[model samples]
Target: MTKQAIEQTGLIPRSIIRTFDRFRIQLLSGTEKLVIQEFRISRYQVLVSVKCLLSLIILPILINCLLKNFLVLPLTTNFWNTHQQQIFLNSDQQNRAFIELSQFEEKIYFEFLLDSFNKNPAFNNSLSSSNEASISNQAKNKSPLKTLYSDKYALNKLIREDIQRKTSELAVFYNQESIIALTNLFGDVITFIIIGFLIIWMKPQIIILQSFLTESIYSLSDTTKSFLLILGTDLLVGFHSPRGWEIFLELILQHFGFPENEDFIFLFVATFPVLLDTVFKYWIFRYLNQISPSTVATYHSMIE
Candidate 1:
């Protein structure tokens, strides 16, 4: 945070400008001679470095993809199908769902009649006859289907309540496997985030060490400087300070108020994308929201 950077940042809206020109001074005061030699890395070193990078990044993605295609997706699908079929095939359970659906239709029809009776004068006049006729028809036609859902006030109320209860029961039955799967998925995600945070925090010692060596190279000279540079270069991988991806991770952690300490992981992994995204995203959204409304409109318009 320098005056120059602040001034420059002020000139452009944060919505449009995603990054700032960061300046870090590697040399100390009272020293002026600083030189940086762009060292070329050999193909072998480049390949080895890339291999390490892939291990850090690609392995997780690969594992997740394989699990999704070969294990998780199939297991979930099979469990869901079998669980649903079992619940449906159960005589009591399936009958309940059927009874529930029938009651729901009856309720809708009754509501429609009620609403019509309210607004239609003719319909209102017919309501008394309709009720009495309905009772008489029920007395005359005593079929099993009619008996099951006869318009006896007590039976009707009881069935309606029972149907609602059964509907909820069926819903819970269907969602049982889903709940378990979600729990397991959530656990796996939390595990990975914890592992990632721990690995990054521990290895940052090496990363910071590498940064120091490479950044220090720009400020030294003479035999001691050359010796230091040679020593430093041998330790660093071509003066590259942990890739942009590394910085991205660090920023993500920081957005969650998780500084690179020597313990635990980020603030929490209780929720996965929700926290990772909210810790960074919604605040940025709030910032943009606080900015000029025109900018907000423009930002959304740009996306649209």
Candidate 2:
């Protein structure tokens, strides 16, 4: 029968024909890639691969460091110092700072009293003499005992002065932290911009890098892939992931000068991991099940 007549009869499935066409195109593309790769000198291939790796990995890191250290850090530090009162971002952050400072003040007060008692020579001598003295002698010496150390009101004043000092220190610490966080956020933004520019300018190199990475990953052993998959899923979406997510969210919020709201953190922890887990499961069911059933089976067995 003529091909046109057979097509009119619809004897062949359209899906099969489409799939065959796709396979043929992929085969031709792959053959072209292999031919190019084979014709290239080994040293040239290595150089290209190295260049791609450096652009993908080391270049971004270097740019981040340069921006953070040279640009963002000094600018943020100067701004934070100049506008110390404006550093907290909001009242909630300010409240948290004071709360932490109060707690620290209490700790310092207790430690200061203990240290004073331990280190005061007069107090030590009075204690030693009291142990040697009788009850009557102790009663006699009770009035003079007040003189053995600094006056109570004087100690209170000193404590207040120390607390004031600590308050200043705490303010400096908070400002420094805010400065660092701002620096990181700005550095990240600039680094992303630079990387985006690089990606656009070197599109061909980026494509080659992606293809190389995909081929390398596919060439990995099934057991290795399954192990990596299990490790990644567990780290991202398993039972303990909530704590990790909470910490990560807190850091992210702090990096952007936001208050670490417990409600927001908990909400994100509750939702994001579940969504991520769903995505992982969907990928496993829809793609991995077709591409590497054995790896999927291995993953299930290992997880179980």
Candidate 3:
């Protein structure tokens, strides 16, 4: 009974382990000469590691948080504040204002008010005198029900016109805002494209190294392969990187027993790119032949 209990206790839970023991054992089987060879092949690997750490990991979180909290959130909040006022009556006008003035009711009231203040008096005077004249003329043209129906129909037409005009103006305003937002997004795309091209021109080695590492790691595990496939597919489908990826990556990290604290999340984000770059550098230097210091030379030779 004691032996069976001890054997059962020896079994490790998959969820608690950070990495596969087999992977670690295989990785450590290599000798010290391999490390020296790796170092000789890529001395500038540290630079790439630093660049990835600063750019991919740290910068993204900062940019995301700052833009969301200070810029995007604030801008949207201000928009809500401005637009919300249009739908509700002012506090000072509470006594005079009709309670719960829905769009349809508001339009009816507005048309009625305008007619009463601006045009109804002259028409009423004419009607008052015409009532006496109308009685004298023995006009069989008048019916109380017909008059009431005509007045109601005219009032409804006036209200409909007013509502349509106001709604159309609002639609136009929203359309203008949408166009501006799209234009700004286009501008950002152009800017990023230029920057990306410049980066490819300057440090093609980093891209090549990271790509190779990603491919290797993705093949090593089904989980990694699926995650990377989803990420790549999203990018290929033209999804926004911040919206599509950042949250996904964060969730993956958290699910893998990573700390949920804000500072740790930021640090993880900052360090993740560096980890990838370092792994790539290690693999290239350890497994492959030494390449030239200059990326242009390497690129041109490859093209040939």
Return the top candidate by lDDT. 2
- The TM-score values for the models, in the order shown, are 0.28, 0.74, 0.30
Among all windows of 10 consecutive residues in model 2, the one with the lowest summed lDDT is: 1-10
lDDT per residue (tens digit) for residues 1-304 in model 1: 4464222337667644543321223345423333232123334344445555556567666665666556665776666666654433234334556787787757766764555445444433444555787656655654433433344565457556767776777677645534344434644575487558756854744454445554454334334443543344334322342343355555544333233432222322223334444554464366534533454455445434
Every model's Cα RMSD, please?
Answer: 18.3, 7.2, 20.8
Comparison by lDDT, 1 against 2, better one:
2
Predictions in order: lDDT: 0.49, 0.77, 0.49
- The parts of candidate 1 lying over 4 Å away from their true place are 1-36, 39-62, 76-173, 176-183, 186-304
Model 2 C-alpha lDDT versus the unseen true structure: 0.77
How are the candidates ranked when ordered by TM-score, highest leading? Answer: 2, 3, 1
Candidate 2 regions exceeding 4 Å error are 1-46, 82-87, 90-100, 115-133, 144-150
Among these predicted structures, which one has the highest TM-score?
Answer: 2
Cα lDDT tens digits, model 3, 1-304, are: 2453112222565324536764564478574666677776555565664565466555445654555455654565466556654422223222223332355567587656565545444444445665676555544545443544457767778767776776666545543443334333434445455557655664765674575565456345444444443454346333353343357655644333232355655565566655655665564454322221233234334435
